[model samples]
Target: MNLRTNFVLGALLLTSGVWSQTGLVPKQFLSLPLGQIGPSGWLSDQLAVQTNGLAGHEHEFYHYVSQTDWVGGNSFYSTLEEAGSYWFNAMVPNGVLANSSVLNQKTSAFLDYVLSHQDSTGWLGPEVNTTKPRYLWGRYPFMFGAIQMVEAHPELTDQVVNALHKFVALANTMLHNGQGQEDWTRVRWPDFIMVLQWLYDFHPNGKEDLLLDTMKQLKFTGAPWEDVFSTELFPKGATDNMRNPTGFVLTWHGVNMAEGLKALPATYRFTHNQSGGLSRIIGILPLMSLFALDLDRASEGWDLLFQYHGRPSGIFAADEYLAGLEAVRGTELCLVVETIGSYLYQVIGDPKYLDRVERIAYNALPATLTGDFWSRQYLQQQNQIAAQNMNPHSRNPFPNDGPYSNVFGLEPNYPCCTVNHPQGWPKFITNSFLTTPDQKSLVQAYLGPFSTRTTLANNNQVSVSVDTLYPFSDTLTTTITAAQAFTYHVRIPSWVSGGTISINGGAAQALSPNNGLQAVSAKAGTTKFVLNLPAKITTGTFQSRPHGSIAVQRGPLHYAFDIPRNSTVLARNAQESRAVDLQFEATAAWQYAIDPSTLKFINSPPQSGALPSPIFDSNLPPLSIEVTACPINWNIAGSTFAASPPQNPACVGAQKTIKLTPYGSTKLRIGEFPVFKST
Candidate 1:
């Protein structure tokens, strides 16, 4: 019954040969081609920056050039960092084909470097780290790329599966000698499990349970993240202290926690309750629910993390550890991307999971860098006032982080984020809308301007095109092109009130959302749905800063005070490189308190377009609100916003009209504001 030391594979799978990939990947939800679900509005503009800018030239950097480094050249980063970025690099072309022309060329070059450099034994990344000092965790990203590409180009499935099979054999051989056991392997077992499961379905002669058994055995003894997620309260005793511990039972790395969040859920799918050692022991831990499976507790865990370590941007502060809820702690880019992926997995099972996805999508996902994707931060703090290299980790905040953690450059503290940030937007678009597991209903996950073409029952084709400025405006219009009538499901955010839906500009029907989904029937041919997704401002009591400060949220967006700042370009040499880094420094004071009672908001939509350009910054968020507030005597903490507001501080500054922008739009702003009792 020991899930830790031994695992028994299920006999339910077809024992004869490799089971069909179709079995694991239900045809229920079909993602349209890369070109079909094209990016529009501000999202498309961001991709344009990606295609012509950093996405085009990031590999040019020596650290990311896998061909040279994997062969003989020296690399500044571990092979895992470079290999993990393959999923992002492969997606550049998929997202950029609509706005730019260089996507295909860039993707071809990237694949050539990756596909052409594999060793005879099926190893692709740096050969040095594949099987030493425990095991290197570089193969999973290639596995991710393989899974994504196999469907687009089925001809490559054989090659992809064969290479991974050889690599897994190599890993099995190495770990069998009691040589491969480390925190990295233990914390990352789920990634390898993903590859093995994919091969089990796709490979012509998939190994069925043997491959999974080998992967399970390769993991370190009795480690990695099972008991902590047993309930809505983690640690089982969380009723006493509900804060989610930053470090796992095995390790404290935030990225591990983020990437492995879905491990238990994925396991439940592959090993449903069976009378086996693995299931017998695993079943002891309570981590399963309906469609989301273990993720219900996972979401609860995340909610607690937000309470203790989270920033207003929908990410937890963890430079290298679970940095507390201070505004100064730096949030790593890898954590941001991996957390998005984790939440996205939840959405695939059901659209209701988008409650978490929208928060990250509207706030943390887009606020990391400049309008152009040329340069980015290795770590971004919620209250950062400057972007440069320095070692403040030894101070009040995160300690494990490197000196250049918050710098905005091609390869700041590390090259990991530089190479890994591309998957954030493209994947969000591709997964925006998906059909239900039964394929009878279409569910909207992420909101924004996009299009989709999906197949319903009886081979009916439905094409949907939506035009709206979501996350900014509360209204959306959806147009459906179909020949047959079917049920269409839309997820209305929980914050929405007084919601109404109209068909073809007809009478607005009063409706109530049930479990976040509103199911309505559409007739044949053209059908249009106009929705009024109303939002209201609400406040919560938190003692973090300013004693009694409140976070202002509307719809899916949080508004923050835009801190005035100045920027200067960072040059590689005396001459400027194609990629120039812009570093910002605070120009105006950021310490201010708002009048909670006098809170007033105004809507300012774009005059013409669905949204405004420079959507994330440059002071153009398409929509903004004016609030009446006064400045307080707050202090800055080590070049960032201080931890807490002064106790019972006097409001000496004059009352002023403060214009607040969306949390994603202000690179330097305070989303969590202190309230002044007197104005």
Candidate 2:
């Protein structure tokens, strides 16, 4: 393409919400670096723990070199490497001085390893003999980290850019040879396209047309995801397979769908004239819903997800496939992190999306992580009763997951979750606050104790500091130190009905939320706003299980019956290297089912000091619930509780008051419980 043709094409893209300068959809809110918004309380503790644990640094999957523990060929390591990179990249910049941030050296050697070992062919990972065609998927995050480090580590630009060029050249050559035929790769080609798109912005010279043409070939020809997503014809409706077709399996895989969700919105950036093929894929979302019609498939896929497999933790159950909404089925750690990134990074600038992000981040995300962070679960259950292997009973909870799938250990069934899990908290911190798409205002999506520093209208430095333990309390106090006035978009969850925002603690004003956000205009100089987000206990029932098996939710936290457990350490938390193996079998009775009518929500006053640093410290959580219930002799099936509370289970004991703890806080508890009555 000539320069004249390029100019004409660029003009068309600019008019369609993409900036011609970047050749991509404009980021509505630019995510600041890690240190700008350092995490405190549970969120900070998670990252800090990951940094010290196997997920953060210790695991052999990340620093694997010898054959004993290679990262399962290059197919998986590249993705794991990408996740670990985010940890080190964000941690080093988290301090006032970039050189001395938390956990900096842990990642420095890995960066050095990557830069020192790049082959002339552009392959940057350990060379192994295997055919893992999803090779390109691993490169997605490498480029993400590389591009991020472009400014922070300018010395790596030429090397990173050249390596991408070589890799694309290799892909283009293989495509001409008809070699890009990985079943999973065809669906996940978006990952490869994403990195190419980023490179198009950074590397723009003679090969601009070659880059697009190369992407055209790399789109993985024969995969008709458009036809798959064009309508809701695939199997949905949770368990019974509502729309069953021949082999409607791969797309149902949670992690695949989570990564593929970004396919269309991203593909739309390139083809300005949605004329069929990949561009026509945008129309696929309308049938999912209007909100999704404009948004990406993330919303559509998430709709189908929650509709059937939804859990109170704001995530769905997919052990390997579309595991239904049964509380026994556990969500993969891979999907959890993927879903969070899709909401915050891929689909930007929507507070409604944060509702899901906050729930999973606050509950499910950490529930899987050990209190010490030395180990994590390969899969975590919604109503997890025990964490032990329990000798693999007559029933099978995970078809592919091993017996100890839910146990908190080094790498229970698979090691992918270990490497992939670290990305969640670090990425959340980097994007904790979002600058509006117009770049005029900033949005506080996640509620926690974090500060925001961004330039306002007149290039004035503005800082807003939040001092409150959120997801633990409803009250939030924010102090703004600004050189000039700016508009601050405060997000209140869609579940919140009524709340008040008083400027500097004077004259409380009732807030009417629109799309889960309240835009507050902050004045110049020092300004403060105390916004109270109302938290309530919401009751929901199991769709697949027996009727009235309820799950309780308050604010973002899910409530579970605090069943006491006698823990058996399968592997000790030898922090530096070995993963923690904690299996907590019930120490106290767990068969109590709360009477919905008698349940009461109670919260403790905010701690004058900092939130506990350990993961899921349940001794005295920020909130608790009081409820009166009778003991139902619930039966156990396989390694998990019976999928459904027994039908007309005989209530054997007197009704009593039992305290409920946060779902995320419990290691041996039930999120979905059978109400004990005459049944």
Evaluate all candidate structures by whole-model CA lDDT and list the values in order. 0.61, 0.63
Please tell me which predicted candidate would have the highest lDDT against the true structure. 2
Best by TM-score: 1
Angstrom error at residue 648, model 1: 3.0
TM agreement with the true structure for every prediction? 0.84, 0.84
**Model 1 segments beyond 4 Å from truth?**
1-36, 66-101, 109-120, 128-136, 169-181, 201-206, 218-222, 230-250, 273-296, 342-352, 390-396, 541-546, 573-578, 639-641
RMSD of each: 5.2, 6.0
Off by over 4 Å in 2: 1-23, 59-102, 128-134, 151-159, 201-208, 214-224, 227-231, 237-249, 272-298, 342-350, 456-458, 540-546, 572-578, 647-650, 676-679
Clashing pairs in 1: 546-645
Cα lDDT tens digits, model 1, 239-338, are: 2223444233444456776766656544444434212243334554322221122334445555556666666566776677666665667778777777
Report the lDDT tens digits of candidate 2 across residue range 365-477: 77787667777888888777788775764576777567878888876787667656666776666667877655677778778877777675568688988877787778789
